[model samples]
Target chain A: MTRSAVSHADLTTLSAHKVRAAIREGAYGGHTAGLAAGKLQCNLAILPERYALDFLRFCQRNPKPCPIVGVSDTGNPHLPTLGSNIDIRTDVSKYRVFRNGALSEEISDISQVWADDLVTVALGCSFTFENALLRHQIPVRHIEDGKNVPMFRTNIDLVPAGQFSGKMVVTMRPIPQAQVAQAKEISSRFPQAHGAPIATGDPAQIGIADLSRPDWGDGVQIREGEVPVYWACGVTPQNVLLDAGLPLCITHSPGHMLIADVAEDAETTILTTP
Target chain B: MTRSAVSHADLTTLSAHKVRAAIREGAYGGHTAGLAAGKLQCNLAILPERYALDFLRFCQRNPKPCPIVGVSDTGNPHLPTLGSNIDIRTDVSKYRVFRNGALSEEISDISQVWADDLVTVALGCSFTFENALLRHQIPVRHIEDGKNVPMFRTNIDLVPAGQFSGKMVVTMRPIPQAQVAQAKEISSRFPQAHGAPIATGDPAQIGIADLSRPDWGDGVQIREGEVPVYWACGVTPQNVLLDAGLPLCITHSPGHMLIADVAEDAETTILTTP
Candidate 1:
């Protein structure tokens, strides 16, 4: 399908599978913040099997920032449990190839680099909760601004496992003081999507120095009566994986993600079966 | 520290650290239910570092049956984050030692058998939720009768990883018809302690044949107007590890546990730091 065939505005009406097919066919290579509606979109982190368990533990240890949404079997690109016909190698619009913890290349497909020892881990993203917040009539400033959510690295140290360890990265959202509690209540139900806010009020408390200049994404203006709320961001795993100095790791670029078949609020405790 | 000096009734008021101390000193060699009220009591699984990652993955894949509360570093006997001075080798009242996936001995302490490559995993238990249920004025039949909770092996296929895989083991609790919703709400808050029920109303749905003859623990009578609710039990990891045929494995004997310093209702996410 051509870019004109599936217009940017019409992307929202398309099913997740169609969107993935477009991405696989190299038709779309843009952010997927609101494309899949109510479906769960996941941040991708594919690593060698040698590092898979340790990385899984890192997510388990720091679930606030790195909630495990779906994990594929080692060497298998198909996340069958998470989505029908989901191919981790080429489903995402764009991919970042990290070699020895450094960005080596940008690619649209990882089929050539896929190895039998590789494992794909899909972590729940803020988009899931953002949708829930929107459903509850809570304003999401980033979505409203049509910009990527501002993310910052904090002093909060992630519990390390093996070689995967680093400071947590958090996404900031400005919420009116009145809706902060309601926002938390709505988002807490989506624990697979980083759950509730990790910190509210001053970003300085969590070691974030400036609101104007973020480490990642675009900064949003905090209104007079609004407090800067922070939720653990999925970028955490990507940041840690880069720092982990692994020989090879592949992750979804910025807003590109693997759209899952799961409902945003599906019970995270029992999503898998073997 | 004589056993007679620390009466079972007096145990309830003791602090978790103190209770662990008494157990370490050989003063307490019995079940740990009601002893550490409000504090989290964890089911222990100690395995070699070789099997640690796969087991951790199994737990991650099957969180409902194996909610990870604490994981000790490789070869580390102390779980400093979970408690002030938790020595996995000697803390629990009783331990079941498995060799080649079969029970070889039941011992009070594992110091003699402890190895340098061993790792300790602490899984959240139903006792935490049971305490919450009782506090909410919900009846817990097992606690009422001073009997062990009924546990059954279900047909639920656990998400497998590496050499670890098995069916889930669930504990049954009969909730009154009117309070089932309330019971679910209260229990849902304790995700670290298996969260909400996996199945309710029927035993046959999950493939349990007989409620009276449970695979583990004592069977409780399902009274009139009460529906049988099943929560993923901690025994799942044990069952899986046994089936994995690992060279060495150790687990807390039924009813014995490692009392953690964390509050049962403490935030499940963001629990650890390096």
Candidate 2:
């Protein structure tokens, strides 16, 4: 099916499992931006079991950017805690293959690359809170502009664990000055989804020299009366792993995530608010 | 000073540092039961640096039992995050020395046993939440009975990390049927202090065959119209360390804790309700 044809369906009508199945069977291979509405979707990170402990520490130390939702048992592609019959190797519509820290391939299935020594980590994504924001009638600039949220590397250093160490990367959103407090209260409820803004107003306070240039994603225009708010981004782990020059790493490609059986609202209340 | 003289002089009036000073100077060695009222008191764990990372992982995996209040920089003995001027070796009123996982001595000061490779971990104690429970009018059976809270070993296996792994340990408190909900809500707010009860009624559900036979502390009577509630106990780490058969380890004797500068209320709000 064409990408445009796939995008036309009312996502509100389908369940998360059905959407994931479509993605798994090559019936769909596109950005999951607005698909599987009201379901928890996550950023995927699959690595060797040897590095799992340290990675878990890294996430614990830096919960804002790496709020872990579910960690698959070693070598098991199914995350029983996340959803029944959800296969990590095939659930995500697209996977970025990295070998020795370099981009090796982008494919629909990693069943060929799957190993008994591998471990999968599912991290909460900002999209969870973005839905919360929209629910509260807060306008998200990037989504309205039909572009990815702009992300930047900051001077803030992540708490290192073993071989994983790097600076924090954050995503930017523009909120009206009057609505900033509401934005914070709404977002803070989603701790699993990066929680509240790390910094607002002056980008330079967090070491960003230019708001126009972002390290990842397309930058959105910051209009008058709107203040730029920043949040810890999920892209952080992938970036850190790449920086560490690990021999192998696998992650879901940007905008293509693993949709879980967990209801978005249920997960939002459990993870974000708690 | 006599214990009677010290007990009457507003024992809860002093700061954590002053309280420790009195203990260190041999002026006070009685149970730290009502001292430093609102401060965060901790269960102490000291081990060689080689075991630090594994223990950290163990704590991470079993957060309910070992909610870390502070971890000293290796061999530093000073816990800066917990409090300024807090010296792990001297601040705790009493210390239990263990050699090859066996009890060696209970001393007032461990300055002589201090080592460059030792790492000190300050874990949250139930005292913080016990105060909350009492304030909310929930009867704490053990406290009213003038006994240590009954603790038991459960069939639930803790997530093992490295060499540390064992069954979970729990502390029991009997609450009136009507007050059980309030007790859970209040205690759940203090995740650092063992958080909410792990099991409410039948101890058998968590693998405890008898209510009278406790692994540690004094067992209290469960009266009519009351239910026994269990919270993960701080003694879990100590028990696990002993089971690991480490060459050396040290902990605060039961009821003798290291008082911290963090307010009890702050810790309560930080974990449960956050």
Candidate 3:
């Protein structure tokens, strides 16, 4: 097949606002890893008001995997706090719709099926801290190899909230033994971005039975003398939400996130509004 | 008037479990400030399931003032996470019942009023860090003067969530100008206990106009060379809940609290389950 002439990759200099605008208008629908440069990108979750409280509590109890950056008001889709012109229904490049614990559809926009009672939740994504890691000379294995970061279901049980309960999910990165401390220190400063590594050195202790296979995302090679460092992944919430079998739920397609205007360093606390 | 011979003061040496047992049996119905010496004491808020979500969100957003230590399962009064045999309906020395947001009754226990729909919320109290401050020889003005800590409603707006919105409420402690940094450093370790000072020096920045008066609790004298340090108070959730005018709500009476089995230092995070 011939390569497409117009693509998100070609617009390297586009601002974060412009990227969001392009996604909103269906101009670009691919992954958004490097689209917005220094801005914070967020994982999106939308659900009905009836389940909003339990979901919010789930995030609160499990901050490691579900650090909430922005929560929309009940029945409101506008996340004005995260971005000046965010419409949850159409802001993301792609959305995975879930119904009764099953993936029902994959679409670029939900404006056609939008409801008045929906509440949107935005969680801090690791992409923010990954940028920080690179700037500090701490290499992220998957990013360097041009593949999705390996994510595994762990044995660490999440502190349950209402009907939301599950073990935590973690993402792994191969870091040189010497740079372990430095990488951990740099990432620890961004609490919104999952913070420091939850586990280092051993994968068996966290219940990852295999290195090459991951529950989500693709695995990368661990070079000689490098140790696997794990940080809580944002996928835990989406998985828990799906397992609850709610009547309706929506989430950003993996890697397709909502780009916020806030700089990565500007976001310090969770649950703060505009 | 002369005070009664038998009082909570005599139960100083009692274990936290024993103290709770006595409170449960209606043996002691006074303040809980000095009891349970090394254990954690908590502020209680009980509401119907319908209001639990919004209330929890309110706490999550305003963690400084409303740090939650334990949240009960819906329709359950047992806070086993805080204590092995804790019964939320009867654990505290005194209970204040509110209906339609108005004070309705003051009771020794809520066993009769307890409903299957009630969800209990436990907030971290200042008593934990005050004990730490005292151990470090940092003088607490209210303690030295033998009066209640001064509390004021600040102009700092709380991050609102679902019908729950209000200004922050803070407790003022007078500290020597030289020890302000030390006090902040020590208190910051206990995020569950409202953490470090939110405001120092002029009260006007946080909306307080006078040091001589307080919205709640008695005001104490600020000696020369001392500055007032304010901390987010546990009273915030109670105040906001009342203001929301819910159909039903219950809280620990002023100064009366739930004495938990957990040690003050054992608690590190907020919103653990019970």
Highest TM-score against the true fold, candidate: 1
A66-95, model 2: which lDDT tens digit per residue? 876777666878775568688988888899
Model 2 chain A poorest ten-residue lDDT run: A265-274
Candidate 1: Cα lDDT at A46:
92
Which predicted model would earn the best DockQ? 1
lDDT of 2 by residue, B95-164 (tens): 9999987899999889999999898877889999999999988888889988998999998888676789
lDDT string, candidate 1, A1-274, tens digits: 6754455576888888899988888788777877878888999999998887678767777888888777777788988668888888889988999999899999989999999999888888988888888888888898899788999999988888888888989999999899999999888888788888988988789998899899989988888899888999999989999998899999999888888777777776233542
Instruction: In candidate 1, list every pair of residues with a backbone clash.
Output: none
Please list the residue runs of candidate 3 whose C-alpha ends up more than 4 Å from where it truly belongs after superposition: A1-19, A34-40, A81-83, A128-138, A159-162, A178-191, A261-273, B1-19, B34-40, B80-83, B128-138, B181-191, B260-274
lDDT of 3 at A96: 97
Question: Which prediction has more favorable TM-score, 2 or 3?
Answer: 3
lDDT value, residue A153 of candidate 2: 94
TM-score for chain B of all predictions: 0.96, 0.93, 0.95
Clashing pairs in model 2?
A100-A247, A189-A272, A189-A273, A190-A272, A191-A272
